[model samples]
Target: MVIRHGQASFGADNYDKLSDLGHQQSAAVGQALRDMGWVPDRTITGTLTRQKETLASMGFEAGEEHAGFNEYDFQDLLSARYKGDVPDLVKGDRKVHFRTLRETVFQWQADEIENPAESWGTFTGRVESARLAACATGADRVLAVSSGGVIGQLTAASLGAPDKMMMTLNLQIKNTSITKFVFTNSAFFLHEFNATPHMMSGEAAGMLTYS
Candidate 1:
């Protein structure tokens, strides 16, 4: 099962750290996975603090996290895309800026944008490589903890289209959500997308979010 890291501490430069609620969410997910009789043979997580913290909270040691699972720095990508300025508008009025940026991201996914920080071709290639590497480990069940962007990229690849519509659909993937994929001999078959069965209760229900 591929799990996205839980809610992160908002408004922090290092968005890789989980918030108090995020930790609780991670623990809940862990418990749910255990209840489902899913014990992974191996585990992998990004180099980011949040990814590692989430796995640890999930009761997985996941020694020596892999850099292959690490997310591309969107901030750096955005900075480069806009010629290193990353307009104050994005920082000054976050809500509006995010909406605008989301549209731009969608365009990028569609290959409509004239220039993007990282091409969709490159992004998909990296994600595919990571998936191949994970499968090569020959583990029966493997767990990977990563971010929304990475998850979305993989989701799009599984769907065989990394276009704007796919990007928009993937954007709806929530925090701590589980998307299962079966791998054999370097091939990936999607089992599920954005499953949040553990958050059925009221307390846990609040843990649902797409960002």
Candidate 2:
């Protein structure tokens, strides 16, 4: 199972840390997994603080750290693309920010962003490597916590979909949502994508977030 990290301090100075609702989201997903008897035999997370914190908040130990699961540097993407001056539209409002982000990311995927932290090809390659390692593990269930970018590209890779599919997948991924993959000696398939059982009820529905 792969899960997106909980909500982070989006407009705050430090965006790496989780918000109060993020903690609640993480705990809710954990509880949902527990109720369904979906205990993970192995756990992995990206090196980012938000990813690590989300897994910990879910009542799991820090099993391993993998840089391959880390997210693309969005700040750098915006800065580099805009020649180091990100416009207010890219940062001031949530809806506008994401809308601009989608366009910017499409450019990034086309190798248009100048001096980005890493190229789009590099990011996707590393994520694919991480996924292969996870599948090869001799464990029944493995839970991985990561950012939306990584999850999106990984999901696209699994489906043999085009690169642009990552944009759609990335935009829709909710915090702490679960995605399941099935891997055997002969096949690796995506069983589920962006499922949020914990936040599906009327009471928890308000907590749903895509950013």
Candidate 3:
């Protein structure tokens, strides 16, 4: 299971932290997994604070910390794309921000943007390495906590989708949602993508967040 970090401090000075709703969503995920009798024997998380916090909120102790699972810096991408000055509206409004982000990522994938700390190729390679290492543990169930960017790219790659598909996938992946991959015969196959069984019904349904 690969899960996106919960609702983050979007539009804040520090977007690395989880919001209150994020905590609730994480806890709900934990309960939902337990109810399904799908507990994992091993867990891994990106080195980001939000990823670590999400793992904790899900009632799991800290597991392995891998920088390969870390998200590519969107702020850095925007800065590189805009040559350092992003428009105020893009920074302030959620809709505008996402729209701009999608376009920027598209450009980044096409090698149109430059100077980002990590290039598109670098990001993808790192994620692939992380996935391989995580699956190498031979655990029956391995849960990984990561950001949408990493998950999106992984999902797209798994489907043999074009480079631009990651942008679309990234935009729609909900917080704390699970994407399952089965690694066997030295290969990883996608079993599911973007499932939120936890918030399927009841008041928890209102907790779904795509950001």
Candidate 4:
């Protein structure tokens, strides 16, 4: 199973860290997983602080740090293409932000931007490699804490989901949501996507977030 990190410090200078709400969300996820009787035999996370912190908050060791699982740097992509004059969508307005993000991500997929730090092809390759590596562990169940982008890309690639579907999934993914996959011989099949049963009710309801 792969879980997205909790709500990040969106709109902040450093988006790699989580907020207090993020920490609460992570704890709720941990409790949820425990209630579901799911325990990871192996665990991994992206190199980002948010990812690592999420795992730690879940009461699991940060078993591995994989740069391949890191999120594609949207900030870098925006700066590269827009020369730092990004649209207001990224600033605050949630509705407009998603609208613009969807359009911009499609543009990125279409190779509209030049001299990106990592091309779309490279980014996909990295994500695929990371997924394969995680599956190669040969454990019955492995947990990886990553970002929405990486999780969406993995699910999209495994199911042959289209770019638009991937983007939609990415946008809909809630913070600390669980996405499940079953693997056999390095091949993966998606079992679930963007499940947030942990925060469906009670105080956890307020913890639901996407960023």
Global lDDT scores for all candidate models = 0.77, 0.90, 0.92, 0.86
Candidate 3 regions off by >4 Å? none
* Cα-based TM-score, every candidate: 0.86, 0.97, 0.98, 0.95
Arranged by lDDT with the best first, the candidates are: 3, 2, 4, 1
lDDT of 4: 0.86
lDDT of 1: 0.77
Question: How well does candidate 2 match the true structure in TM-score terms?
Answer: 0.97
Which pairs of residues collide in candidate 2? none
lDDT of 1 at 108: 64
| Candidate order, TM-score descending | 3, 2, 4, 1
Give the alpha carbon lDDT tens digit for every residue of 1-211 in model 4: 9999998887788878989999988988988898889989999888899999999988887698788989988877777777778777666776776677777778889999877888888988888888878888668979999998888888888888887677888888999999999889946799998999988987778888888
* Tens-digit lDDT track of model 3 for 1-211: 8999999999889999999999999999988898889888999999999999999999988989889899999999989988899999988999999999999998988898978888999999999989888988769999999999999999998899999999899999999999999887477888999999999998999999977
Per-residue error for 116 in candidate 1, Å, reads 6.4
In each prediction, how many residue pairs overlap at the backbone (N, C-alpha, C within less than 3 A)? 0, 0, 0, 0
Cα displacement (angstroms), candidate 3, residue 97, comes to: 0.7
lDDT of 1 by residue, 1-211 (tens): 7898988865677777998888888898999999999988888887899999999998888754666567655665566557678777775565765576676676566676555556767776777777777788768989999877777777777778735644565567777899999878847888998888889887888777655
Total colliding residue pairs, candidate 1: 0
RMSD, every candidate, angstroms: 2.5, 1.0, 0.9, 1.4
Q: Residue by residue across 13-82, what tens digits does model 2's lDDT show?
A: 8999899899889999998999999899999998999999999899988898889999999988989988
Off by over 4 Å in 4: 87-89
